[model samples]
Each structure stands twice: as structure tokens, then as C-alpha cells.
Target chain A: MNAADLPSSCDLVVIGGGPAGLAAAALAARAGVQTVLFDENAGVGGQIYRGITATPVEDRAILGADYWAGVGLVDEARASGAVIVNGAIVWSLDPARRVGVSIAGKARLIQARQVIVATGSLERPLPIPGWTLPGVMTAGAAQTALKAQGLVPDGRTVMAGAGPLLWLLAAQLLRAGAKIEAILDTAPRMNWLRAAWHLPDFALSPYWSKGLALLREVKAKVPVIRVDRVEAHGRDRFAEVAFGSASGERRMKADLLLLHHGVVPNVNLALAAGVAHRWNGRQLCFEPVVDQDFGTSIPGIAVAGDGAGIAGGTAAAERGRIAAIAAVAALKPDAILPQVQAIRQRLAREEMGRAFLDVLYQPAPGHRRPVGDTIVCRCEEVTARQVRDAADLGCEGPNQMKAFLRCGMGPCQGRLCGLTVTELIAEQRRSNPAEVGYYRLRPPVKPISLAELASLPISDAERKAVER
Target chain B: MFKRLGSTGTEVMLKVDGKPVRARSGDTVAAALLAAGIDHCRTTPVTGAPRAPYCLMGVCFDCLVTIDGVGSRQGCLVPVREGMAVETQLGRREAGR
Candidate 1:
């Protein structure tokens, strides 16, 4: 995890240390290709298996079996002898497969013949009134705190919005002895019809049992209300949550408000890497366009994990392995073909139940495009009305919206608000999100401190070349 | 504000704006601050309103704080260390060379 023996270049560089990246790096290393894995987190396991090495057996039990299952994977990865670099934030991944990395506040570039992008996904933005309040947080945030630090909400936490994570968190917290006031489910009642249509595939797959268990645990302990409209109201911090149901609106006092509509691919790194991306309507997120075997439009660059799409952790790991097999085979002509074939078979099997989950957890249309004065860009505080108004004035795409309103310009750099803006613009223009387009990402993809940039360890010759 | 579940880890003491906060050894700066009832991690540059960690992961970047004099570090990602000095990252400011 140190940069002490780090190299300036490698045969293959994997960006992200999540399930996919871990599998990719381990496989490539095992195949004898010089590999290096970069992760921003302190540990290797991504969000799903976060703190796996640190959490005790009893603690693992509380996190459930799916998380505990990753222990073996992490062990296998560590045994692979890959050069693992933790705390390395990949700021720029260009088309030429050059990765600009910042480690311990120092900047360096990694030149790789091939790069695997497995940056994973972010929670779908849940924009509502009082969402920016100090007590408001995404369900992923709550889960990350718990997974990484074993922290659980100490006060009356009101869980809102919809998605698998919403119910899963409620179940987890209930097990942790945390106080949960209620759950405001935002999925349409009609979504059951859509979910039922895919039930056959879901029942035959591995996720069915786990999904049912989460639902059972949440229903047995918590009061669940099915609703569409929700808003958090407070002065300084979140004081209460107001939501609507078929029975009409209801209000409840809350110490914390955790929101999550769903998750979407965190494609900033991939997009910044100059890969082609298409917006996925079913998942309501932008995903990189990768061909079968995870090779991006650009050769030698592959994307896996939720960064390519929200295929869950199990499938993401398989996809990662598949991408690794493919990339390594291309790099090393003598690489075994049978290994790649076996991984493909596993990946296909692992991907079976995704349709059911996607249909069942598809967020309500209201969430994708919030109406009224709901804020779309949290960083700049641009409202839906303002974005719609801009679109009404012939605003064409998200990039232009950025110029007019600064929607994607923030410390977060469009991660939180980009999809919302695209959806908003698409809604006004009467086109789909893909046709409406996305933000043109520029480097450094992650904002590097000026101090770090100035102190970049360029040799005098390299500096002179740049000066020339 | 949160607490550990299932098991206990070793505890570490850190400071937030000169105020002492006790946290588990592996607790992120944001988690420690939250456990100590300090919700407002930073003030925004645009509105000057108090903001805490929205996404405990690095995606939101709302948890930015000064850790050991390094400005704009994500509090939710930085593990708590003994005697670490923390400050709220508020507004636009220049970093000195």
C-alpha cells in the first residue's frame, strides 16, 4: 500500500480497487503480466466488501453472509502478488492510457499498455427540499459509515426514497439495534407488475433468497409506507420528514434523514478516459459503452464493475475477471484461452437475476426528473425550474446548461448532479437522456491541489521538454 | 452521530477545531465528528451554509475538511488518527506553498 517501490509505468494498470478491479488485478498478476492496482480507499475491498479484513467474525455476521463471502476473494487477491497501491487517487486517465495519480499529496503519472477502469457507482441523487441539511445523508453514506467504521445511526433515523439499498439498510440497522422511525418507499405500486414479469428469472437465480430475506427483515421490524412525493423539512438540521401516500400526506419527527433512489455507474473516470458512454434508461444512470468482454470503444482500455453498469458486486467481480482475461490475453499472446472461457460462463450465470432487480427497483419517474423548485445541482443550488427554464430557452445539452447555470461545476465535479441535469434537460427537450448528451469531462478528473501540481516531481529534462 | 455494532475496536482520540473527540481507531474523521455530535463538517463556498458528509464515500466531496493542516481532504475517507488536527473547510481559500 506504499508508493516506496512504485514504478512510473507498467504493463497493465487497474484504476479502482473494488470487486472488479481486485479480481482483474489478481487474475492478470496470476497470469504473469506485470500489474499494478490503484485504489483511493485505504483498503482493497470496495464498498460492498468494505472493511472485510478489519471487521471481526461477529461483526461480519451482522453485515450478513454476502459481505463475509468477500473474505476469500480478498485473500486470493492478496496472494496474487500484484503491486497494490492504496490511497492513490487517479485524477486523470487519458485516451493514451496514461493515468495521472496523486499519492499522499504528490502527483505522478503511470504509463500502462492497458488500463482497467472499475471505479464503481454512486448512489442515485435524491434531490428534495432540505436535502442539503446537515443531518441529511444518502443511504450509501449510512452504510459506508457502518461498513468502514461499524457506525450506526444513534438517533431516530427516517429512511426515505426507494431501491434495494433502502430496504437492505433498514434491515441492517434493525439488526444493529438502531432506532428507525419509518420507511417512505418511492417505488410505484405498479412496479410490481413490471417486477412480476421478470419474476421467473429472479426466482431461478441466487439473488432471490437474499432479496426476500432483506424484505422480510425490514417488514417485520419497521413501519413501511409506500409513497411517491417526499420532502425533508428543518431549520438547521433535519427535524422531520414529510411524505405522501395513497392515504394522503403524513409527517414524522426524525433526527436523521437518509435518502437513496438507487445507484448509478460512477463514470467520471471512464468518461474522462475518453471512452464512449450511453445513458441506460432502465437503471436511470449513465454507463460507459463497453463491448462484450468489457473492452471499451478504445482498444487496450476496458471498463468493469458498476462503472460499466450497475451489475451488482457478484456480477461485477465476474466482469472484472472476464475483462482481465481478455486484456491479458491481448497483451500476452500466449495467455490461455480456456481460462477466459470459464470466466465468461460464470459471468453469464451471475448476470441472470439482474433484470428482476432492475425492474423491481426502477425508481419512479418523479425521482429521475424532480418537478417544481426541487434542486437539481446541489453544488450550485440550481433548481429544476431553473434548469427547465434554461432548456425552454433552447438550451441543448448538459454542457451548455453548465455554461448558463454552472450545474456541473462544484467541488464534487458533477458526480452528484450530472445525471439529474441530463434528465432535466432531456425532459424539457422531449428526448431521452442519451440523446440529450452528458457533461464533457476534463482533467485533472479529480481536483488536485495547486500545491501538489506545483511540486510534481518532473525531471529537469522533462521540464525542459515541456518548456520547449 | 453513530455507534459501532456487534463488536468494539480500539479507541483513538482526535481533535476537531481544537475540541477533543473520541473515536474508534478505524473511524473516519467524519464518523468521529458525527459520533461527537458535530454534524456541520464545513460551510459551503456558494451559500455559506453548514454541510456535513452526504456520501460517506468520496463521491459527494461534501465532507471536505482540513486534516493535519492539509486543506480540502475528504473527512469521510480519512481514518481517525491520534492528535490529528481537523478544521472545517469553508468557502474559497488559497493554499499556501
Candidate 2:
């Protein structure tokens, strides 16, 4: 099929189907723009809102189902005459707002007056010795497995890491009949108390009460420990986890370990399109540098969601709506900016709340650095010692480590090892992890084969756009 | 949300590792497995830590076990089938191994 064979043009093209993308598409279509939303997942909610489809209505109340519930957004967008495209993975974005997408094993190019990139974030993996053990997983991944797939890790489980997500996941596991061996949270004590100040704002809603109730039920049934770090051990698989607690270092034998630190933005498409970006010290990731309009260096192209920065679901959705409005305003300058300004103010408030929550739930500094012998990159089986050795050899950056040891050049595109590598280098350089900067996300983020690119439907216009 | 199966007062029987475990049909596999008191699943390759369903969704791979000899299957996601054979997978095992 040729590019012309597809829809010649649309008013807007939203490149992700998560809360942000869905919100953007819905708002754009509501404004009478011909909009299409595409996503790689079979469903629309993205990772943060994983179980929207499977969770029953009664359970939805406790799960914050309405918060995600992107299906409703999709239906509303479709009602407004927007095109919904599932399982569509966008490969590249040209300078002219032309998007190359892969669907049904075929690639095609779509041209739009404006494009919104709401690609969500990926979990930041903390590499420790034996992290590659079969039983280990990210907290977000665990949520998806249980809520979507109805799968369990084991009968006995240990939930470890920082953030409110740890407590949330632990509660879910308890409901699922898994014996919670321990809830090992690495959040510093001071941070937790400071984070508690925001509790009043959160507690205004009954929803917070229900969440706390569920957590209380779980805590009553299991031991919840605040630890500095976890040292997982097993020859071929994980059998024991050793951690230093207030009492002392304790080792617990368990069948599974769920580890989560936080998330970083997915910036592959933005970087590939040569969009300007800067490092966000707070989230420890590189976010696309955008103006108050959410407009990137590339004209008519906007970004939101975890792709812009790790602001969680509600913030991502708000940012997405803002980006969509800005994109429309770019074409229709006569459009009202009052609504946009209001939404931007709301986003700022949400972002402030998120920042407060993040500081309170941030991982303890000790968790950032594993013992020198621990492996940092599971894909290459690269050890902390190896990375430190490279840093000692004056390997100044993660790029040099990539060149010397191929640490961040794995299948995961460094989502798992990037932050850890940066921290390792910082430790060697006697500097802060923020000063070291995050890894650069290269193009073809999800890894498209050469044949896939060759198969893309191209037109004279799209071909010209690509050439430029 | 409500169903009646056999003499167990409408309880549904799901084959976990080829053994009949009775649970409410609407209950998640993790919940049912936990209710049935079957806890030990696969062990972590590095730490040998005993793991169970941590996140009752697909985000964490901690709940992985073999259903009908298939490895890396999230136990929380795999609904209880009538006669599914679930096994604990250590890692990505080679076909011949």
C-alpha cells in the first residue's frame, strides 16, 4: 500500500493510546478535528492503567479503575468520530509531522497537521547481584501479570522497593491469596514522614480511605519492614533475600521478589526526530525540552505523558489534553487560550503534588549503589565491578561504558540499566548522579528491523519528508 | 461475580498443576491459589528466594510459573482451567533441556 493509499491527511495524529494519548485524541476530535489514536498494546490504558478491562465494576472502586478507564475515553473519541487504532507501534516521526507506524506486520506513513506523542514511561530496574533470576520482576510488570493475565508469581512473595506503588502492589498480592513474606520498603524514614504531610490532601477523598483499609488488612496479615537494601541470592534462581533493617541484617527465604524503584520517560521517538531535550534532576531521566505550549523544537509536534517526564497517570492525562489543545491552537490561532491556561494551571498543581509525593517516596541513596561485585546489566551480564573499572579507566559517561562494555545497548534500550550505570559512574567520579546526567535515547526505540522500514508505505510527500 | 459449580456450594474447580482446586470462578488465579494454600512456585535464579504472586497483575514477572509446561506464564493472569497443568519454571529452559 502506498502512503496515499492510507488516509491522505488528518487534523491530528496521537501516537500513543494511554491516558494522555486518549485524552488528546478525545479533545481533538471533540473540537471537530479528524483525529486518530494509535497504540502498541491490545488495549488503550497503557501500563499505569493496566487492568481497566479485566477489573469488575465492584473491584473498580478499590482499584481506582475510573482513573484509568481509557476505554470510556476511546468510546467517547470514537463517538466524536476519531479513529482508534490498536496494536499500532509508531516507528519514526519525520520533521513534517509525518508519522511512520507499524500495524498488522506492515508499516505505513500517516501525515497529520499536528502530532501528539504521549508514549508512556518504562520501569527503572535496579540491578543487583542475581537480578536476572527468573523470579524477579518490576512492580508495574507484576501488576499487569496479576490484573490482566490472572497469573501469580508464587505462593510466597516478598515485595521490595520504594514508593507508594510497593504498598499498593503488596495489598493486591495479599488479596490474591499470596502469603506476603515481607514488605521491604527502601524509602528513607525522613522522606516518609515528610510525604505524610500530603496525606491530608489525599485523604479528602473516600478513595484514599479504601486504599488505606486494604493496606491495613495486608499489614495485619504480614510483616512490613523498612530496609536499606536487599541482597538476593540463589545459584540458578532466587531462594533468599538478605536486607539490612533497623534491627540488623536479616535474610528471608522466598519464592519470588518484586522490585520497583521508579520510572523514566520513553524518549526514543522524540530523540530520533532530533527534538531538543534536557535532563530532569528530580525524575533522573531526560525529558523533551518544550515550551509552556508543550511544543518541541520541531514545529507542530508536541509531547506529553511519561514520555515528557514521569508524572504518573493523572498528570500525564492533563498534560496530554494541554498538548492537544496547544497543537490545535498552532493551526487555529483564533482558538481560545483560556481553557488551555486553566488546564495548565491544574497540571501545575498536580505536578507539585507529584513532586512532593516523589520526594517522600524516593528510594534511599544506598539502594542506588549495589555492592561492587553486583551485576548492573543483566543483558550483557556486566558487573558493577566491570562498570567501576571502566569508570576508573576514565570512562566519563554511560556512552563510554556502552562503547567499552555495551552496558546500556541491550534489548531493553537501557531502560533497566541506564540509571544504575549513571549512578555507578557518579560514584566513581565522586559526583552526584544528577551531575552525571541520564542516558540518551537513540532512534528506532523499540527496535524495528531493516525489512520493516523498507516495507513502509511511502508517498512522494512522505518520501520527501523522510529525505529532509 | 457469583456462580455455582458443584456440591461445594457453587464452587468452581480449577486444575492447578493438574490438581483440582476449588475456588470461586470470579476470583483471580493468584487469589484462588492463595486461598487453596498452595504457595510455593518458582524460585529466583540468583537469590533462590521463594516467590509468590506479588503484583496481582502482569507488571511484575515474580508470579511466573508454567501452565501446561509453558514457562514464564504469569500465574496471576492464567485463569484456572478445568485441567491445566501448572509447573514452576526456574528460567527460560532450552527445549531439549
Q: Which docking class does model 2 fall in?
A: incorrect
Question: In model 1, what lDDT does residue A41 have?
Answer: 81
Residue by residue across A1-468, what tens digits does model 2's lDDT show?
A: 223345857789998877888888888777767788887655567776664554432344334544445667656666766788765767788778878887645677777899998887776667656666645666776666555444445556787887657777676666655567888878788886776877666555333655567578778888878887688787656778888867899888887778888777777788777788886766666788987767899988988887888877777888888898887777676654448778887777666556555667676666776657777775455788899899999999988788999887754456567778888899899987667766666566654546667886556997888695
State the displacement of the C-alpha of residue A252, model 2, in Å, after optimal TM-score superposition. 1.9
Interface RMSD of 1: 1.8
Q: What is each candidate's DockQ, to 2 decimals?
A: 0.69, 0.09
DockQ of 2: 0.09
Docking class of 1: medium
Q: Give the Å error, residue A146, model 2.
A: 2.5
* Candidate 1 chain A lowest-lDDT run of ten: A53-62
Worst 10 residues of 2 chain A by lDDT: A54-63
**What TM-score does prediction 2 earn?**
0.78
